[model samples]
Target: MKHVRLLILLSLAGPAAGAEGGPLVLTDLAGAYAPGSLPAGGGWLALECGPAGCALRSTRLQLSRKTVLHLDEFRVPLEIPRVKGSPLALLHGLALSPGPVTRWHGAGKDVDRVADQLRRRGRWTVPGDARQLALSWVRLPEQGGFRYHLGDGTTRQFLFATAFEGHYGGDTTPRVRWAGDLDGDGRADLLLSLPDDNCGFDDRLYLSSLAGPGQLVGLAARFAGRYPACGC
Candidate 1:
């Protein structure tokens, strides 16, 4: 059987009133894999997003024999009986909510070079006129952590290190889904899946805004949470 790629966009149901006085709409729908194409004994991938732009929520999902995948931040995989011929139904289920399906753009060797430079020197250099950015995991270190970088042509700064602090194992770094002009500032913003320390496996959506001199500042209301281990 030939593997199929499923690409679906979630429609936004309009901004609802959130308790935090910010628009309550979903964001960061990422790491989606087609049911038929999943690896045997499917594993879980990170789902990161939250209500407010400042707050972050981390979660995971397992691809096993189950129906009605719960759309939340903390639900674990349940061993429900399999329902045959319903794989495509999962896409429709997600369509009930409103949000943009996670899409990555401008991810290529150039981005990899930026990541490599960041890993080695904690900085990257790009042409001064480039815009937009995307990233992908190139390799995992022997110590068990992910390796990737972010850049398109213009931006060459390491935003992940500045957002959180603490030593993340080589395999535990967050996944980069997309990067573009998210805040209408003409500068690229990042949508990252950041791992939460409490769960140690699940991840949260981190939206980092570009600041003066190519620095990244976490847009949290209070900046409270377990900081990422520094010295990556």
Candidate 2:
């Protein structure tokens, strides 16, 4: 198997941390992998941003004579073998305005609140065991949403769809982070941050369990009326 290296290049005007003390604002986010090694039909996945949000966009990829894949909003699972001297390479890039930093904080009472809302809204059902919860990030044209896999590891569900007021209705991007094990449930949890309708960011906490159902809670109330340092 051939190993691949990743290179990230980011250009910003100010320090990642602003004088006001907030998340580092990134003026430019761009990078490439195996720059000139990919085949002629291969190209880097570029980031597209507008009123909607930022997402990875790229043309289709011709993996082989019999394999052609479209890199659209839908997810395509592919398993590529390491062929010595192969010309295939992976690349990606992104750019965002300077703003407060966003990250996952972990599972907690707030996550439980979100989970309750999901149940009330008929979006999700509490699993029998908290330890069965699983979390992952997903992108879709209608709005970026998170994926929750039940303990069975095969059952999956969408948690929520986020859209900013002025952005394209279906182009919202979802940003999720792993927060390790929280709530002392012996299960892993997640943290999500997405652009809200007001153009500000909304933060949510989620806890996954192996012995119980999953829980999601929102932390926006804690910063009521206060705009997140970062904007959509």
- TM-scores for all candidates: the values are 0.30, 0.29
Leading candidate by TM-score: 1
What count of clashes does model 2 give?
Answer: 23
Question: Against the unseen true structure, what C-alpha lDDT does each candidate score?
Answer: 0.30, 0.31
Candidate 1 stretches with Cα past 4 Å from truth are 1-105, 108-111, 126-177, 194-216, 220-232
* Alpha-carbon shift of residue 157 in model 2 (angstroms): 3.2
Q: lDDT of candidate 1 vs native? A: 0.30
Of candidate 1, the 10-residue stretch with the lowest lDDT total is: 5-14
lDDT of 2 by residue, 1-232 (tens): 1111111111111122123222111111121111221232423332233334323334333332212222322222221222222111112221222222222222335445554444344233233334354434333455344343323355554555433322444323433422433334444444454544442333344434322333333221111111211221
Q: Cα RMSD (Å) per model?
A: 16.1, 18.8
Query: Scored by Cα lDDT, where does model 2 land?
Result: 0.31
Cα error, residue 164 of model 2, in Å, equals 9.0
